[model samples]
Target: MGKRDREILKNICIESVAAEGNALAHVNGKTLFVPLCVPGDIVNVQVTHKKKNYMEGYMLELVTPSPMRLAPFCSHFGDCGGCRWQPIPYDKQLEFKQQQVVDQLTRIGKLDLPVIAPIMASENTVRYRNKLEFTFSNSRWVPFEALRQEAGAREVPPSPAPKAGHQSAPESAPLPVSGSAPATQLPALGFHVRGRFDKVLDIETCHLQEEPSNAIRLAVRDYAIDKGLSFFDLRQQTGFLRTLMIRITLTGEVMVVVVFAHDNPEAGEDDAARKALLDYLQHTFPQITSLHYIINTKRNDSLGDQEVIHYAGKPYIVETMEDLEFRIGPKSFYQ
Candidate 1:
């Protein structure tokens, strides 16, 4: 084994934050790994293991701090795992991410690269995500204890109606129910917790996505649950609904695709269900221009082999940025 392969703890000053949100520091003839650290942070790290040309370590303590550090927005910041740099200021995070990209090109790519250009800032840092996917899990990861209290109130006994003598509280119409159960909460739509697919974290609002995207996500989940659709089990890979995909254009056009694991050639396609989903989406969100449905019998997450058998409108959506216009289909990659 090479000398660098031996594990050794060391104190090092962090130079900058890396792309995956780990702090970067070079020890005496070794590399170190520190989590939740940013640039200009002087820390003491304990080496966990040694690699051929580098070392892996955990942050033991911080000696100096970076001015760019800021409080993370999400309550599940370190635990939930969807975002890595939420604690760092957005502008500073962008700078660090860009620097990491440039460093990879120069140091790892071994190319005589030119001076890196400034990073292009996203138009809407909040509510900018065009796509999101959520799963139906038996258990949920509630960020705080207060969320449980709110959920319990929905199930508890109702308060008495206002007395006849007192001015009656403004009467509110009852919420429509699908099938037998009331609608599920909206913020409950979210990604799986880090390292735990069976456990889902309920995100009340995500700043990354557009507003309509959240509405569509909640609606689809409600529809599927009402129809008694089964959510996919990642471990067993057996279920009716495997994944939900949403595509949106810069011009506000929306397309939704729901993937199923099994195909019912005999049952054929359910036109009514398709129409209901499409109609609900169109009526609720007029910005949608197209919608599609895909079925995949494969046991894995790869969507390459999936067949898109149905489409509601145009097969693709167009996005415009500056003078460039790009055509995006169900399988197109985002810029």
Candidate 2:
């Protein structure tokens, strides 16, 4: 390849859809894989790798959008990172998904197999099912757009202090302050940032779950903040509220599990902390059939080994499907 051809490609026209939900385009006879793009879209990409048969690059700029592309329905698409293929039409996405299965079976498996059935696409795309987990972080994941707006000038965090509008912690609420240092970082109750586990993006409205899902999550977060409930700090592994798990069954029964760090008062913990949050939730959303809480002192937040205590209602929620009745625990797997 010539020197010009080897340079970073600009306004490269996408040729076709490629494997692994990537777009394929030939650059100087080498196939380049560009993610978060569809065919007919022209984009400027910075080449990161050069392989023998294929190359890789990240999308730098979108020059011309593909006609097949549709507007993303989710507001957190760019930063949240779960729904990368939202811009692509659902039918096109389904086509690629089906092709992916065939490609894997024929190319990778190398086995003689009969024609597979067509991929089944869900009729309802938004909030089709139940169950979602949102994490709490002391520091919210800052989006690149914020930095871009700053234009190389970053905003300095103010000296650590209680967030504005939060005056005093309830008698039962956990310690509101992280430490003596100025309370600069605010709390975030949302999904983890893409590729960065320590950071989480504060979600405003998630379309993953049905009606009360968003309502319940927002209410809990707001109530906790207003009552000066301490948000769990992953680094120090202190604070009060940690992860939130919500499950809704086919019978419309909802189960919520609120995980706290501990109940030791010396560590700024409180036994009533769980009760305060649960009482608020129960009063606000009376539809909750089963409400529970857990105390996880370890550095990790996995609840498999932790003991789940029932705060208000039944310990296990029952779900019936045909002839089988499955009782779900606080941390049970559901399809």
Candidate 3:
């Protein structure tokens, strides 16, 4: 395959944004993957890399705006990387996404299926997300360029520390430091950083899930950090806490799954830590009807092997959709 590197600024009209967040466009008989673009948008894109079959680009300017465009509700719209269609009106975004699925199925899948139909729009656009996973790493937090520019004149500095090894000055010894600076405010709750899992943008509020879902995520993150719980590393497959999974049902039932790379002293040490977490969740968030701990020993991404050894409530959470009740375990898929 031939590859070329060029900076070609052209008026690229986006047909749709793929599921993975790449805006698809046909440029000079070659497919282009443009970032931060939506369907119906006429943008000035700079081709950064080129291949025999496709090109990759960055949006240079918005030459012609799409009527579907709207002011994103989230302040961290471009930065969080969770909801790429936030800029496009929610209804329009769903319409385009459905169209994208139909296009790909007909074009790539080559399946002579029936005419693609419109997707059933989500009932609650904001706070509809029932699951969220946040990563932790010792790296700098970088927001999207657009967000940084918008917050140009107004930048807030990091909060002042309470001094190392000193929790309350003439009182406690800094709360017994355990793991890496206490997580420093759960890294954004929205989505993974583009092309980087270790990096995450802080999402203040998201409109994709229930409001309580976000609140529970942030609260749990803070609680874990205060408890000095470690976040897991997917690349290295090391860390005390690998990931946090939250499951909620239409009946206002909540379930939390705390996954670990390996067992911790609390969980392993007579299951004290695990019990404590369950107790806390039950006491603090009475809405939580189920809680589980998943221990993943494998060094791969297939979570199917991971087993739930402990449970605070029922083994699975039941979600009702289209008059069908789906039983979701700790290792189940959202869809």
Candidate 4:
């Protein structure tokens, strides 16, 4: 740790929420930003970074919980880097967002604009998104809670090098473990951790998408783990499974796109495991209207220029928007 890491500010009161969802405070004329903290919270923070005009830190202790703060609904709320304002009520969130717009236009820009309209509220908060993308990672990010639990436990062994094929050997490999030692590597299938593209948080459930989305993701992950399928390593750019995309339309249509890394014939790439996984998905999820797969060999996870092969079901799904029918292909861009 550096000098800033050892500096702990005691009893700092968070005055407001900043634009980036950090709790804001003023200490000795310099602005202090603390993450995972709500306004009116009195917290003890360990300063991570410091500058002349600003300082940023993570909360070490919540000395006083804000009355306006509500319990976050998601277990991975603070760590996952999504839905940061979940502690604030929906009405308060709307108000804050409106104030943000007013401040940005009139106060910050010095514009002589008329009163801005109130922001529209969505009917549903959870499970309202039409699409979600999940990344497959060989190194699963170990949560702090798990680390704490395994503080004095035995050191976990590092994951073996993944083969170039679909399924690796040693099918009976022990399940991944978490520990304080540095050798704790695990396969994960979920969203990437905030600021760290190389590590992925192993998500058990995500509330952003509807039922079938979570079910399908979990099923795929479980099967992959059981079959010793290699997850794509973001840093090394190896392994088989790359990404999973699920799209659900209001017109009762579902589309699933499974992206696999390039097959290496030199290292004996097994196509049978890939076929088995696709067959399992097709047989299990009959509701999936369109199923497609792409072989993305590029270093980055972009499929814009890649060809999308239809594995099963229809090649495209239909979405109806007020009598405007749109055919959504694997590469189509829709909100």
Candidate 5:
């Protein structure tokens, strides 16, 4: 009925970090899953979802940081959407990963499972990934904290707000929190946020992909913004750039696929913008041995049924397996 009577859970201590990177807690005997936090982290969670057996929420405020929590290595830690377990210790990550597997096999199954071995740590944490696909979005997601702040400010005497999905606000809107700035209407070039297919987080300095990945991504975004290139909008399903797919082999060969939303060469300056983007890529990234482009007007940014065009490089890169050579095209699924 009023702001003071609102049932926002405050000072909720996270009990344990789940396998899927969500911190698990219980409120009134119902499971509550929270993101961007670790076990022992005391936070005020704003419930975004409520169901019979469980609830989902975003961390409203960090009342206290977990003692096991370490400083996130990546600058885009919480915002960019991936690497949610960054605050947790490495050992904990491995433990949870193993436990997740054992969970489905042992706890949730009927089989008598064997003793599960510890997860072997990867020698490389950052810059270890060989392939990564990035999406281009015209709008960016507004975090829950800001959304809640905006909702509070816009409260019309608290007449029972409808579902969050019902409100017709663009993904990026003017929602300012006490400490953070308002979300922008600028375009985004990054990985899709988990469960939010229409939203992209605009990744900066992704630690997953190795060198030249982050560089190329940032370069593409900057050049596109500077050149007035159009980013693909999921809602309207229009624009020039759709998605970027980059694949690198250990043998030093790299393949890049530039997916355009639609191909309109005869249209005014569309061809020029396409050519300019390609020229910049060719001139900038000399290390790209295999470069290609695709014209995909499909509703989704998926590579399904799309024709790949080899623009300025080999049709396929060669990968040797002992005595045989394997051909890897721009659309290859080796990885």
Candidate 6:
């Protein structure tokens, strides 16, 4: 469609949270869904997709922020696919989720139900998840906002050369010098960007999992980069570090599983590099009750059929509930 023909909505108040966490509003008789907004928000949106029953749009401007909206905790909130619904308060999130369940049961299932009680709320909003899996990619995603900010930032003078007697400090990753190119082509160890399988966001910190998780991931990334290990390219399907998985139990046991890619048949496995990385983690994080690694030769990330090798500590971590104890392996399924 032409630019002039495109529909632009103005000052529409969001009514509710719809399925899949999109902000809902009613335009005439049809439903409108806008992303990155909450109920009571007034926004101007440009419709991207239209249908007989509903419409989808991207927010042109948040004309007025919603009172129900809270400050999102994660820096990668909008771009990261790991989470959504961060703006809504936890209580309000529960309310919307509860309503979603009721709607699904009554409308879709066509079932008669008794009065539904308020959905149970989590005591802790952040760092409550038991598991998190991260991907290693050579192509790191640099946010447009960051590039723009760097472009406008004032320039600083470069440091002078050190004296002959003194050793220079270690070289860190490169930064976008002219705001045109991204920081060093260093590999990123984090979650993938929304809708982009090849782009991975370099996460500095994550609020979903507790301490030692972030530290461990960062340490491994830095170590791998320092050791000159290759990061996996999603499109090319080659690299040494492919994925990392972390699992924590209520009993304070931690499990970490690293996946290495051996896509090249001729190069064979880098056993020395793999052993060194695992050894570093073992010495660095003594609290890791379970540590494992997997050799994933496949193009995909599925580890179901792949073998999980035990490196240190126990083969599995224990999660206890009442008098029963459950062992969670590298491939075990848990809520």
After superposition, the stretches of candidate 4 with alpha carbons farther than 4 Å from their true spots are: 1-5, 151-184, 265-268
Highest lDDT scorer: 6
Candidates arranged by TM-score, highest first = 4, 6, 5, 2, 3, 1
lDDT of 6 by residue, 189-255 (tens): 9998766777888899999988789999999999999989999999999888999999999888999
Off-target runs (Cα >4 Å) in candidate 6 are 1-6, 152-183, 263-269
lDDT of 5 by residue, 1-335 (tens): 34333246778989877756788999998999988888899877667677899888777567788899898898666665578888888888888778777878877786798777788898777776667899998776655544455774553222345344333223332111222123446788898766667878778778886668888899999999898788998989988899998877666777788889887667757767877888888899998888888889888766768889888878777776678777888766764
Provide backbone clash counts, one per model: 4, 4, 15, 0, 0, 0
Angstrom error of the Cα, residue 15, model 6: value is: 0.6
Per-candidate RMSD, Å: 12.8, 10.4, 10.8, 9.1, 6.3, 10.0
State the lDDT of candidate 3 residue by residue for 1-335, as single tens digits.
12133454556789877657778889779888986676788876656677899888667567777777776677655555566667677787777778777778888999788766678876667766676665443222454342234355555343235334322212211111111122233333335656666565545566665646777767766666677665655456665655667777776777787766666565465256556766777778777778887777677545776667646777777888887888877777866
Which residue pairs collide in model 4, if any? none
lDDT of each residue in 181-217, candidate 1, tens digit only:
1334322346776556555665555556666777777
Q: Candidate 4 — what's its lDDT? A: 0.80
Q: lDDT at 5 for candidate 2?
A: 44
User: Considering every candidate listed, which one attains the maximal TM-score?
Assistant: 4
Q: Candidate 3: global Cα-lDDT?
A: 0.63
Alpha-carbon TM-score of each model against the true structure = 0.67, 0.80, 0.72, 0.87, 0.81, 0.86
In TM-score terms, candidate 1 sits at 0.67
lDDT over C-alpha atoms for residue 81 of model 4: 54
- The residue pairs that clash in candidate 5, if any, are none
Identify the superior model by TM-score, candidate 3 or candidate 6: 6
Q: Model 1 lDDT vs. the true structure?
A: 0.62
What tens-digit string does per-residue lDDT give for candidate 4 at 145-206? 56644656854444444334322223221122322225656688888765567778888889
